[model samples]
Target: MSPPKSAQRLENKWDASRAKNMSEPEKLLYRSNLLGSDKRITNYGGGNTSAKVLQKDPLTGETVEVLWVKGSGGDVGSIAMDGFSTLYMDKLNALRGLYRGVEYEDEMVAYLPHCTFNLNPRAASIDTPLHAYVPARHVDHMHPDAIIAIAAARDSKALTQQIFGDTIGWLPWKKPGYELGLWLSDFCARNPDARGVVLESHGLFTWADDARDCYDLTLDIIQTAMDWFAEQTAGKDAFGGARHQSLPADQRRAAASRLMPAIRGMVSGQQHMVGHFTDSDAVLEFVNANEMERLAALGTSCPDHFLRTKIRPLVVDFDPAKPDIDATLAGLADAISDYREDYMAYYERCKHDDSPALRDPNAVVYLVPGVGMITFAKDKATARISGEFYVNAINVMRGADAVSEYRGLPEQEAFDIEYWLLEEAKLQRMPAPKSMAGRVALVTGGAGGIGSATAERYLREGACVMLADIDETALAETAENLSARYSADVVRTVTMNVTDEAAVVSACSNIAAEFGGVDILVSNAGIASSAPVEETTLDLWNRNMAILSTGYFLVSREAFKLFRVQDMGGAIVFVASKNGLAASPNASAYCTAKASEIHLARCLALEGAPMGVRVNVVNPDAVLKGSKIWQGEWLDQRAGTYGTDKDGLEAMYRDRSLLKRSVLPDDIAEAAYFLASDLSAKSTGNIINVDAGNVQAFTR
Candidate 1:
């Protein structure tokens, strides 16, 4: 059954004066009503709506007020005054200059300090700068499932150009932050009369002098796309010309409840509850269809929707007549695992440090053969909405395909938006390490000790790791051990001296050529010297710097170049010693080289920020096992200086830290994992002490 003609006309009305004449309170209600009119219209806090309210500035004796924007965490359909963040128009415009050339996420965070207005309960939208760029009094942004479905399809640009024509401007996907705002500003400046702007792989933005005009423009564009889609695929059926059968409501609800907790756990601590089925027959029928797999591969309508709907649809393979619900649940669990592994491989092929690793599926639409579609969400309303969005997207995509072909935005472009700064910043503020799946990492000096441990940790977190060291035997052995435990192709080992510039460059180039790109780099290779200042030879100092300081510089520079050229922001980890921070007696050359490496990382952090790169240092205190530095004259002299037996000296070093435990390679690797993942997206130019608490020892 189609929507009535009156309903369609009501949906299309562009009543600018109705909003212009309404009071602020009336306008808020109208906005909410408009937001709720379509379910696939918006998801969670995926959309933004705003109104400019003018008021008198008593202190300044002029007319200036707030531009009320949708606050973070507030759904547009249910937002109130508290959900809107009010920013001074003049101050927002003034902040534009601060955004230029700002590259690092932290630097952008620092710009918040320059704001003159009270930030209040709601933080300013990440799109605040874009909103400010618009001269319009009102603006609206939404990830309308229909619009995104059309945009995400293969050949989306052509489809969009065909449908949107000269009315909308398209901006390529970028890591959204100040750069995105600047891009939009430039576009708006050039096209003063554009109806709206669409950020590829992101969403849509529309603005006008009146709130109603802005909202209606959004509706008109979406409706046009919808109508165009319906016409194109009028005869094509999504169900693959298959018949559906009905399933019982009680059985569907039970299955949904069983699936909720597993999916919720995948998203960390997000609350998710099962919603009741409204179309039990449609769901049962779809699930029973033979072509369910083909239907599920259409991909999401928008990249961001993965946060709520996951990357692909969940195909429930179960017989409703079968009484073994537990067996069916087990089958679902296996399917999820298979899905996660497939996702991990996809991530490995295309993901960079800044990308979002796969999480669990959020909503599942079960298509029972004879029944309709049963969508499961945290609540009834959301479930119903998700179902409608999925169905509409599927229908349109199928139709668009029939017309010509549907091609999505480029894979790399989608990755940029998926790992965008706006979203990565939110993940960074969380407590635990974010997903590290699909990242390729290289650890220098990854033989027996600290390096091996670091490689193991990265492998555990789903990274394709390369272990490089001067010791060929140790490197091969460690690689084999890790591979045997984790399976083949999990770890790759290459023998090379970090001090050789050609060797470092070749190693980096080979990895990038082999794996497509390198996302994480750990510069852990180094040599140590223990002579006093006067006794230290120039030759010894030079050699120490070559391996410890210069080697790090060469490798990091290569990594930086690869990251920039590939357009995937990468992460570099320098494994410096605690001696870099605190002075140790009778080790001048070793201390100096370590200290130099630390400073090198800080400098790179600043330089790399513009290109979306992050650089950090890990200072581990006296790791004993697998360290070549622990052998030969260096170890004996250091032990003698401490006035203790070799074992006693090692114990003293371990006791120096606050944890009072020996530092291990695993500890440093865990720290490296955090730095490489989304956990450290906002962290750069920072020193992480993996030395337990050695710094506290000097203070005491």
Candidate 2:
């Protein structure tokens, strides 16, 4: 449906207001709101925005500073000045020559010192180079829902040509990070006067000498596509006007639980998971309808979305009248398996790596026969966004079919773009400790010593952090203290148990709703228990696993969901101790749980790799300022074992590391920021040493 004329006028007025704004903050907020207004409008961290600011660098004299280009973790609507990583334009432009060969990530990290900032934060945007490459004073890149929908249709190229005319240039899909930057750099260099660039199976990029021009160009391009789609689909009977049926809330929840593990496994190794389920009558009935297969064959609107929605939706052939629930589930599994095998064959034909393929599909659209269509996501927010895109795609496809057949990217081409080398280059950039700005992070167990230090480091690096912990009093007090020092928004507090599934869900939902989606998730919530393996009771093991192992799973799960669905892919930092690698005496449960987390991070890294999500672990040794294991009896026990007094014992642990210093929470947090930012994009599943130099013992 076309947006009402009045709403269009309001948008126009807002655009005018934004154009008139000379203040940096106002322009930032304006562009953010514009990008956030639609679901299909932006992929999680898939797009970018920037504004040129006049600043005087100490040595560079007067130079334009890109005051803020949306950092890796920020959402357009909620991002602030702090969300943008400021860089001297001359330096950024000069670095163009520095980007060479396959080792971009390392090069970027090494160059972090060149960029001056009060806080040496980690992780810049993957497209930092692209933003730097653009000579425009302001730039906006987005994967607008309307554009993706149109682009996903059968004749995307023709449609694009019809709608955007010559103002936009279409580049076939390539992996996003470095290759994209390179491709864009070449394109911009070749066509200096081009208004924008559209990445096939990806999104759109717009730029101008001013912020307002770039913002309006994005809106105009998307609106044109939306209008073309509406015109093309005006009288399509392809939808069949089928409506979906709703299921009982309990059943829906149960179904979601059953699907969560598969979804988690699919996107494992990354942090953050956001899922949404729709059992509305229209969805269910349409899903279960006879023509469902025909409907499902319509490919994803864009290639990038494949990481989120997968290649196609799962159509469940549900028989609500079945007397045997187990049998029905078995049948569902069989059907899903068949679908998965078919997908694997497609992958095998194009497979480039020996890594096992994802077991869970990115999206599952179930057809409960008489019921409605239901979609599952890693997180609710993602599911909702996926649903929005699917609905729009369906509408456009149906409309196009009314006039003629719909077409999408050719299969081989789609695969090539999906596995493009350029895209791979983008994913491998290292974290820049000095360039991170305007990003937000949520560090669980923030009241703990490691968490507190990490939070402080993030604050120091110019990131807004939401510190969550089970210790409400401590969490609140810490947040208060941090707030007193930083901007009120820079530090917020949430008290919740990570073990409670509901709390995990609520926490993620609330964070996204409040801070736009978190850019970094530091899964540092854990418990330490030491007992002989033979003496460890089931209860003790279960409790340890619940908080230490399962808690990381829950938090990382939610974070991945959010990150996947948002425009910017986020970074996740899991805090596992050296014990995770090397066993400690009488610490079986603790070691086992930590080890599990490490493995989980590895899995997440693989899954998130294709989507710009980077996951890494920080193994800090003997930084026990806030750990339960650091207090009274535990301290005495550890000191006695080490044959020294408390302080001496601490030094013993510190000296075990190459650095010969206590690994502070700040150290871990700094590592976390690096992993979460552009600085560590290529370093997923990496085990970063925050433990000084304790690797020899751990390896031995």
lDDT of 1 by residue, 476-515 (tens): 8888899998755447777888888888877875554334
Question: Per-residue lDDT for 413 in model 1?
Answer: 54
CA lDDT, every prediction? 0.66, 0.65
- Ten residues in sequence with the least summed lDDT for candidate 2: 1-10
TM-scores for every candidate against the unseen true structure: 0.51, 0.51
Off by over 4 Å in 1: 1-29, 100-119, 243-292, 319-330, 344-700
Candidate 1 lDDT at 402 equals: 47
The model with the greatest TM-score is 2
Write the residue-wise lDDT of candidate 2 on 372-445 in tens digits: 34455433445565666565445444444444455555666656555555444544553543344546689898
Q: In candidate 2, how many Å is residue 395 off?
A: 5.5
Q: What local lDDT score does residue 260 receive in model 2, on the 0 to 100 scale?
A: 34
